[model samples]
Target: MCIKEGLRLHSPVAAISRETTQDFDLGDRIAPEGTMVIMNIWMYHHMEKIWGPDHMEFKPERFSKENIDKMDHFQYVPFSAGPRNCIGQNFATNEEKIVLSKLLRNFTFRLDPDHKS
Candidate 1:
């Protein structure tokens, strides 16, 4: 399964940048070969255009399989993307899932009545 929930809630990177391999027109702008471009992961993640009006809302159901294939790869990349995602992403994911499962099974958490986190 795709890491839809984990990625949407807690991304792994702040931003990413790369140089263009050749001259190209990005609609209204011209990007020359070797020109540098940066992706603001945080901004994009919360953008209305890319993620709808309630972008900041933690609605993992947005990534349901029915909707997953429709989204562009450029959006919502928590662990980086392509060939540069975290080298140990699989291991990390399993570890976190196991820990969370254990916590849920072993504990009864209660909010502090008089204390604020």
Candidate 2:
């Protein structure tokens, strides 16, 4: 859940561009084949309609098993989505967890008095 929250708040790839493979109807309009589509994952992650007013808050429990199902499947995309999604996503997520766990277990951290939050 922490990892998912981190991704939602700070995705490595802020935006993605792709060419449509076929004519697609977006309801409001139709995009022809070969049309260039740019998706801003950062904006989506922060949208109040999708994530609520507290979207900017760092709340990992939102991804808990009991609450995860309430979210849209595409709402928390950090590695893009679909067939063109990042192949290294799983490995990267695992690596982040391992490194964070080790750091937490081996070190004691304190905020500096001069630091501003």
TM-scores for every candidate against the unseen true structure: 0.77, 0.87
Where's the lowest-lDDT run of ten residues in candidate 1? 1-10
User: What C-alpha lDDT do the candidate models reach, one value each?
Assistant: 0.78, 0.91
Q: Which residue pairs does candidate 2 place in steric collision? A: none
Write candidate 2's Cα lDDT for 1-117 as tens digits. 888899999997899999999998999999999999999999989999988899899999989998888877787888998888999999999999999999999999997999876
Error of 2 at 99 (Å): 1.1
Candidate 1: count the clashes: 0
lDDT of 1 at 44: 68
Worst 10 residues of 2 by lDDT: 69-78
Flag regions of model 1 displaced more than 4 Å.
Answer: 1-3, 110-117
User: The CA-based lDDT of model 1 is what?
Assistant: 0.78
